[model samples]
Target: MKFKLLAAAVSSIALASPVFADLVLPWMSYRTGPYAVAGIPLADGYADYLTMLNERDGGIGGVPVRLLECETGYNTEKGVECYESTKAEGSLVYHPLSTGITYQLIPKVTADGIALHSMGYGRTSAANGKIFSNIFNYPANYWTAASAGVNYLLNENSGSLEGKHIALLYHNSAYGKEPIRTLEGLSEKHGFELTLIPVDHPGQEQKSQWLQIRRERPDYVIMWGFGVMNQVAIQEAANIRFPMENFIGNWWAGAEHDVIPAGDVANGYKSLVMNDTGSEFSIYDDIQKYVVASGKAAGAGDNLGTVMYNRSLYMAFLTHMAILKAQELAGTSDISQAEMIKGMEALEITDAMMAEYGLANIGPAFSVSCENHGGPGLGAVSQWDASAGKWNLVSDYLVADMDLINPLIQADSLAFAQENNITERCN
Candidate 1:
């Protein structure tokens, strides 16, 4: 009996050693990029969360999680290089915040049995889990955001959009195109005319698009912009005397960087907030005590709750939770990319979990599965209040009507399939 027990112990040790080699996290972030000002806070917030987990909670599932950082400059080729360089390290999962990179790498990651978490951005059609099995999006996709935008306008304008023109001024990239497919549907449904205005990337110098906005005189303008483009759009809108309130931005368009440049002129501009805002949350306080105080904080200290920072932190939190969930199902401290992928597919976010994280009213705690990867469609509308120095949620967790958006998602998924020569596994 003693000899048999010794042999079993040796076998168990061998199995455990290999698992440890696969669990480290490889982060592809931009500490230096054209959009680094936006990317830095998010990266710092994300890094801070991992630090908090390691220092405060004893490092997820009793195993220490280490973050490996590689700056991608929000460049697609650089992002691919990062992926190839790190894949051998057995990265449990990846969150490439840039939509261009995410679109480029989806198939490769799926084939490698690794997961990609793009919560608020990326190809909107990927929200259908049936097609993009390894991709995870916690909140609704761009389609849902576009649908919500349409619904908000319909309600505010007394339910009639007949003969009204809606203008889309978007960065000319995969990220900007995400919501156009959805908005087109909404236009047809509500009898609104749609205009597409493409702005080349780096999103600056749009004298021409603004000129068109003035000439066309659309009833509503939806800005699909980021970084310097956001501010420029606002300033242009102000210069053209376009109704600021009549213009709305996808979540990326509204931030301290965007509005602060425009200052008081940006008051009442609306944005689709990705998560809860403000520093009053418990997580921020924890970050202050641990990350900021420890002298490990990255980026400008004042950039903490700026829009990009919050989005990055939110992305990091979801990735962390997915890892823990994967370990739970595996029933072991050692994990594999495949195990982490399963964890991501099976995880759900409860109200209690949100409150514990200091996000009490963040809304629609996510629930993931094989068929539905976009866990939930939950977000709120926030309007800029210049004097208070922040965008505040004006509406409660507006329960986005998924019942209407799901079919639209399927149709878009089908269209993408035809274009890419990809087929849904379900059919």
Candidate 2:
């Protein structure tokens, strides 16, 4: 009887062993929605990179990663449900990937002591780490992208944009409206006429907006759209014979699926890029060898080198680095959510580290600090080459004018803090 009891106890311990050995990384993904064109590549890239780390390096810092993907369909309600359901599973970090969802989870995550790493597409004010203790929007944010886009246009126009009419065609959503404030501020500062056009969600129909654009004949058109909106906008621009070169899209609007549908008409259409696109990076080879070769690729290996795919890959890599840093700081491979937040806050990605990881010139070097969660707001512009079927870098890395962005971040973040009765940390 004692022997039988011993065997049962051993089995119970074995069953519980796996839980302690793995780290949960919950991914709020959207693979079956209107935005799936952009979502599929991003989900695949994020999952595949994490898979590669597990295969190539036995996970970050020797702790195997458990990637749990709960489809949010890019819906805010679904995203919150996914977070609530998975937060109890010892999730180390959360990447919501939607600004609306990110806004919803900001308070919930902060209360739960979980870190929300928005990467490039969440609350721009979360860049102020002092006001947002549990959130991180590193490398670049929407405001940064907006300022950089304006700066690039100014440079293209030989320093001054006086009397230049710039049209901003944006999706009428939280994500779409992120850049309007900064763009408006820049317009006031530079003496440029700014026209605002809002495209409703799903972004399938843009006929009236394009008709207005054609009638207005703005010198340049800046697009803040995603998914079907991007393709339809490009098609409409082509229909109106707008100069594709003068049409610029924010980072989200420049993916492969976005422009490929427009064919050669997409040629010369420019957009901002925070990281290098395509599978030429050394990490891709490793992914090809370790993950794809072993029949473990996330999305059939077709999206291995696209713009959105590469951006997601970079996001996963940075998150992995943060995990490693957290492990080191905590002196354990298995880290808690708080420890992961500390790791993300103290993380730094340098040029040398990029070169070592075979990501040379792929992304801008940036660091996370106690007071500043957003990294140096650096990005470049890429022009689509439909004939070449690729996006080529068109300009050097342009730094966003923090002079225009800082005050807004302060105002928004401070207001949030005041509303929530939370004290600022870096004051």
Candidate 3:
């Protein structure tokens, strides 16, 4: 069924005049273009989780969740179109999964009274939910990732980075540039030299960037790339004989497909992680039985335990919990966009709660508040063991340098509010 067209329905989610009994969830997926390899697994993981909910538990709170997947091909224009087409389907919440799209939809979603969860990628400043009411980027964001990367380096250098030279190799897009300011602020605070390297769209050609890296021999290289850019950059790093141990990629750049092309040469390369990867959680066994075994698994059912797959699972889990919260707040199974927004703002994810969902330690504990929707900026570092064909978390969860990141978020968010004439809420 598409969505409940509750003409006489008691709930406020009825967008049409047809009999329906489900809540609409929009997945703005990009299963094509340069990001297909990365996007496919994400989309599949999200779908499988919802499928499991329907098959195993008879849907969330006895109401089926109807997923509307629209392919964005990672294009901003297409992402907007997907949102416009699906909003009327009673989709109270949207997961854009694209920073460019998130930037464009912040105002639109606010105007429509819809909630948008950008997860780990999006406008880093959207963490200030007071200004951007309908926008959220919890668990972690780019600024946190940047600070976490620097924090890891500081720990390795005995709590200081003075005289060290660090370089940021990023995609020349809104998503990639999200970390530049934070990294720059971190460099100044730690007394380290910082270099910025930009890779064009699709990130196919990076010989010059790698050449610069080889020539400059920065003490460390942090990459913020996506899709083919990650694969190509890893190959280039291998070709240049850069010490894999000293090179790091943000979560987006560190996946199985990213390093498989370079074989063992990519071993020891590290990346920051917001959520633990792998399907070691009990949820996987449940998913296998309820969703996969029944032939309703998403895609080929082969991406169940991948990094991006687990991330998507985490994403779905958040939404699921929020929906339950929405039901509680609204005192009904059917919830409207306004109730969903409140649920998201008040949602809290504790380790104990995660274990209840069979996702113990999925990520650091986080709670969303009116003042802070971004959750505690906590992240862990994971390293690639090419011989083992897996990425392993090497450090305990580390909190971001919020002193540096908080100010940036405040400045940018305030500027946005001023430009858009948005009155700050949560007072």
Model 1 C-alpha lDDT per residue in residues 196-314, reported as the tens digit of each score: 99999776798999999999999999988988888999999999999988989988887788888887888888887657777666788887877778876764466777777777777
Off by over 4 Å in 2: 1-20
Model 3, position 383, has a per-residue lDDT of: 96
Model 3: per-residue lDDT, tens digit, 270-345?
A: 9999999987999999998998888998888889889999999999999999999898988888888899999999
- Candidate 1 clashing pairs? none
* Cα RMSD of predicted structure 3: 4.9
**TM-score comparison, 1 vs 3, better candidate:** 3
Q: For model 2, what is the error of residue 216's alpha carbon versus the real structure, in angstroms, after optimal superposition? A: 1.2
**Model 3: how far is 1 from its true place, Å?**
35
Off by over 4 Å in 3: 1-20
Model with the higher lDDT, candidate 2 or 3 = 2
Scored by CA lDDT, what does every candidate get?
0.80, 0.91, 0.90
Q: Per-residue lDDT of 194-263 in model 2, one digit per residue for the tens?
A: 9999999878899999999999999999999988999999999999999999999999999888898889
Worst 10 residues of 2 by lDDT: 15-24
Candidate 1 segments exceeding 4 Å error: 1-22, 399-404, 412-427
